[model samples]
Target: MVYSEQQIMAWASSFFWPLLRISAMFIAIPVFSGRFVDNKILVGAALMVTFFTLPLLPEHRAIDVLSHEGIMTGLQQLLIGLSVGFVLQLVFSAIIFAGQGIAYSMGLGFASMMDPTTGVSVPVVSQFYLVLATLLFLTLGGHLVLIEMLIDSFNTLPIGDIGMERSDIWSIIAWSSRIFSAGLLMALPAIVSLLMVNIAFGVVTRAAPQLNIFAVGFPITLILGTLLMWVTLTSVLGNFTNLLAESYGVIGDFLRIRR
Candidate 1:
């Protein structure tokens, strides 16, 4: 059974292109992207997914893997995968931002520790929210949905020079603002509640100058902030769900997948 050079290249291209996209996605997505997950595991998972996905992918035109065109095609695949993962990454970033805001409002801004996921220092409050969001993300099968979208993209976008368009890039940039807006929305209730508490402390300080706000108000503010967060925690999951849905919609638009 002699396989011609063309036939061999076609098989290689089939595996290589999809591997590039799937591997890139694994490197960018939230939970899997964390340092806790071993690189070897990621590679194995990417390979496994590519193996399964190859059958579902459309027939490929044999392009030499070492050719200039092949390089461009690989880049396009990488970009497509990264873009999809990046959109969801922003949603998690928003969750972190909201936690940071709430921590600062509660005067716990200084109470920060290193995040194992991103390897950066963040407030304990933010870390708390991050854990919850991660759990929710997994529980809701968000990872599965992302993989399904990526598979669908091969049909809609295909592996070629024609990848993400100018409009798609602009949409991602514009959607990046979600980190601030969505975060602000999540933190707003706690922020406003804390602000009012601070204002009341200011009034008390003004009416009674001898009273030490640092000694008296600090503990009270901390207690109140905790209570406020407990009360508002109920809505955090709801906010995340809405944001996740919006992100999926954005991804669908760019990937040309109908929701």
Candidate 2:
């Protein structure tokens, strides 16, 4: 079939723009961006998704892929995809913060390990929370929901120079404060319980200065912290669910997706 240069550029532009958005999303989203997932597999998956999503996307205006206008459009799509993923990433960061707080309270601050997902050193308590959060994320089908939202964004957000505005960026930055607020809420139980335990120990130390409170108090704090965590684990999962729902709402708002 003999196709004109305009027809050829049009076809390439349609594929190129959607691919940029999908690929950028895969590079930013949590599970897909982890070290366990190979780069080659991620690219292949992104390509496959882009190919399928192409049929669902709205028709694009023909623009030369090498032109300045094309470059700006691509950047807009990339930012939209990244912002969606980044908002969710903040939820996980909040979970990490909660874990760290609990760990410090339990006198386990020295117990650190490298997280395979992000390859960063974190307290063992934090790592434990991370594992549960990851499982909950998958069990709740969070990954699937994110992909669906990304697909929907093309219709709502479209490919153009118009994208996230200054207010939208500010909203995301404001939402990031949840890392501390939500984390504190999650860790509050452990923090308060441990503080009371420490207070009691302080009272005993004053009563018996020769008792060597360090030796006696350390083990008791560790045991109490473990028990407290076990008792509150269900509450932690509930908090995560609420946080995840909030994150989805933020993404929906940012992408202009209804519901």
Q: Who wins the TM-score comparison?
A: 1
* Alpha-carbon TM-score of each model against the true structure: 0.98, 0.97
lDDT per prediction?
0.92, 0.90
Candidate 2 stretches with Cα past 4 Å from truth are: none
Model 1 root-mean-square deviation: 0.9
Candidate number achieving the greatest lDDT relative to the actual structure: 1
Residue pairs in candidate 1 whose N, alpha carbon or C atoms collide under 3 angstroms: none
